[model samples]
Target: MSLLRQLWIMVITITLLAFAGSFAVSMLTARNYLEQQLYVQSADNAAALALSMSQQSKDDATAQLMVTALFDSGHFELVRYTDVAGRVVVERANHAMPEGVPVWFMRLFPIHVGAGQAEVSDGWHQAGRVTVLAHSRYAYLSLWAGAFRLLIWILAAGLLAGIVMQLLFRWVRRPIVQMVDQAEAISERRFITITEPRVIELRQVVRAMNTMVARVKTMFAEQAARIEALRSEANRDPLTQLANRNFFMGRLAQALENEEFAPSGCLLLLRIRDLAGINRRLGRERADQFLQFVAGKLASLSADRHDWLLARLNGADFGLLAPGLSADEAPAFARELLENLAELRRIEITDESDLGTFGIAAYRHGDALSTVLTRADQALAQAEETSNAVVLLSDSDTQATLVAHDWHTLLTGALTGEDFLVASFPVLDRNDRLLHRELMLRLCQPDGRLLTAGAFMPHASRLGLMPVLDLETVRLGLVELGRVSYPLAINLSSTSIADSGFVDRLVSLLRQHRDQAGRLWFEVNEFGFRDELRALAAFGERVRPYGCKIGIEHFGRHFGSIPQLYDLQLDYLKIDGSFIQGIDEHPGNQQLIKAIVGIAEGNDMLTIAEGVHDDGEWLVLAELGVQGWTGPAATGRLQG
Candidate 1:
């Protein structure tokens, strides 16, 4: 039972005991007073009657008349007059029950008194003795009336006390409830504090809880800072603060090999002209500052493009990888870079007008990394001959570029038709058991070609059609879930989650399929999630009731904001593929992964590694406490 209920029962019991005691005392006191008054009246009346009889004649007629008159005029149970020798002269008596009083009450508290007696005289001699007794019906009535009044007063007071107790209980309950909530939040890995109550005991409890939460927050903040530092040390270029050559190559390889990555994109290579000559003309410090300035400008230009990868490839060469950029748009992008680099010359950082040369190479999926590098290098050699110092090398068989209107038409037509399809990749546990299949949306053309989400999603987003596509994907996932017994995960775009209407529709769909909702998972990319945390949180809240799971894919890219995840209550994290690539041979990345696993475990979230390509990587990830794995290796194991 709750403490409040126990207290209420105790209060009621004490009130009843108090009422009983008071009633007993009041009834006893009243009965005693009434009994005393009755005795007094009997004695006084008997004395007065005796005197009256003494003053009158002592004859039988006179005595009988006086006795009868006295008995009739006053309340008496019995009245008698006898001669001095003890012979009866005259007698009168009456016996009757009291009215308006309960028999039970009379039996419980019956009034008792002695009858009064006196001597009578006739001509200076005793004629007969007169006796008078007073009835106790009036006394009983007074006692009963006083007892009833006491009971009514007791009842009124009890009611008032009960009301006051209820209000007091409610006031006490509020602070206790707040304390309970704070404790639960802490258990869920969300450190929250409550206001200290005015009550001393409750205030102490709340203060202790707040202090613990503050300490925990500080601990987590320090841990996240350490992990971020590890990430920088492992992947960042020391001088330029851009991704180092190894990290950049690993990310480029993932984009090229991952099926969900963009089908085609552009790679740009920028080389400083005569770096040794500039270093000798200016001091080493001045040349280092110049390099930093160039790196800063490149980072600023790609600040808004989360998909773009900027890296310091070497001391004099920098690389930019732009996914989803077409060959037709490569020249314009290269000219933009050239224009930005011109700022260095105008600021006199270098005397040579031709500060740098640009080489742009367009690449498609399945192309060799070495082949792309060679093409960019050839483009750089050609740019050194050109006056503008910028050249773009394209593949001869590149596909035709689609305009905005054409893309809208294609996507709308495809969505309306039955050409949209979904492809599943298995995510597995360390025991080789299937966790869930991550579903990717695809578009089937009339020519029997499959177009991945990367090929069309950008256009759909631009046309505000992500809500429609995302809802359809959820519907398809539900249908598949009903056909199969296993759970399924689907990706949602940042744009779709930001749209309130889309959230409503998605939640409605999940509600309609409540049984399948538990088996359905929704994930958003970490890049998008960091910017739309509030929107994603609201979306999670709406769908959580249906048992739908929400998570962030491509996790660990923003290690600095891991602490912000306490309030999200996410179900899982899909570590980015770049960090997972060749993790078995990299100790620094292993520590980073271990830290990530610890953080996720602390929050009760599952950590899944993405893009596992070999048994070595899979084994290392499993040893590092990854709960799930999804990639080429995981898919191969599922097939085997």
Candidate 2:
């Protein structure tokens, strides 16, 4: 039971016990007083009547009359007049009993009193003894009345006392409840402290709890500082602070799947005009400022639509996915965004301040991502011909995009048809030594044409077939691990990690391939990592005995859940490609990368660079304490 309940019970018990004790004593006292009064009345009446009889004549008639008169008074239970010679002259007795009082009550508390006896006298001579017994029925009525009133009063007092005590205890123990809540919050990764209570003992406990919360907050601050750099490096474009390609694409993919954001949605593509030439004429700093300016305008345009997905796709390209807007509304949205970008001329730039062009594509729910992008690209190309106008593209072939349950059918067939293939990319260490092979997934169409994961994984995810697809990849990866002597790294999707059945199958697979377990490593993206780290950790524990490594890709994309990362059994973190694309010149990225490297070093974890394409980026990564690298640079090293 809770402390409050237990205390209340104890209090009630004590209150009842005290009332019972007091009530018992009062009842006995009242019963004793009534018995004494009854005895005194009997004795006094007998003595007085004896004296009165003595003053009367001693004749039989007179004595009988006197006895009859005394008995008729009803004050005495019995009255008797007898001769002094021990002869019965006149005798009278009463057979009266106390009434209205329970027999059990009288039996439980029997009242004992001495009966009255006195001798009568006749002119200085002893005549006969006179005895009297007073009635006790009135005493029984008084006792019953007093007991009923006493019980009612005592019960009322007990109920009132109990209620008052319950409220008082709850108030006094309020601090304890707050302490419990604080502890629960801490367990949930939220550090909340409570104010000290007035009670001395409770105040001390609250102080201790508050002290612990403060310490945890400080620890979280130090850890968050580390994740903050990684988060910014991954989630945002370095120059614009807008969502990067991968994050935006994830959101866009989600929007495409949901009817709330599809069927009546539009995709707007903004391509900066003459970005390369502008960089040459206005210098690198001015060119970046112009891009930042353009990004700011795009940010403002989508600010009101919190669900809108906006991203810096590449150097001169940006994409926005806005749902809940009709196809006819696309022109208005594009015009507003284009006009906002045209504000570049207001920034005192030379030459043509044409800003950028807008490309819009509208599609229904379940439209393939490729079709949307293709339409948007075509519109963008057409818009480029018109200088600064917006271009809209309508799908020429609606049958091209798979909708309804088509993706499920396709994914299931692909799994069973053995149309899935695994491709390995090299992960090179700082010394250019091969650390592992990152396995990439590919699905082939019935026409025998190969398709990259970028082509169909979105559909697979939307259809909730990622577990099947991901498991197939792991299965193929295990086979590949046996075929090769090196470890193979595989990516896991959020859906797979969230599925208990998938975890079970994965555990069974790892156990079956115990000999090759060390050769297989699993990776989850930032989205997957954030979505189901606990599940991942549980799975990790289940597979840890098999000697496997689990890491996160695109580690810096989101860090709001970084506090939970401490609980996750992650082996390494791969910095996102956005930060790696041009690391050498981007001083901001270099500094953030350095901080991330420090965090990794402190945690005894490895840090790897993704999408390293040049020696400049490689050198910068080497200087930033990055241990491994992948992408074109690693591929080139492997080829060499």
For lDDT, the strongest prediction is: 1
Q: Flag clash pairs in model 2.
A: 77-133
- lDDT per residue for candidate 2 within 461-527, as digits (tens), equals 7777889888899999988878889888888887898899998999899889899987787888876
The digit string of per-residue lDDT tens for model 1 on 111-180 reads: 8867788877677776677777888877888888988887788777877787788888788789889888
All candidates' lDDT scores? Answer: 0.85, 0.77
TM-scores, each model vs. reference: 0.92, 0.51
- Model 1 scores what on Cα lDDT? 0.85
Clashing pairs in 1: 82-128
> What C-alpha lDDT does candidate 2 achieve relative to the native structure?
0.77
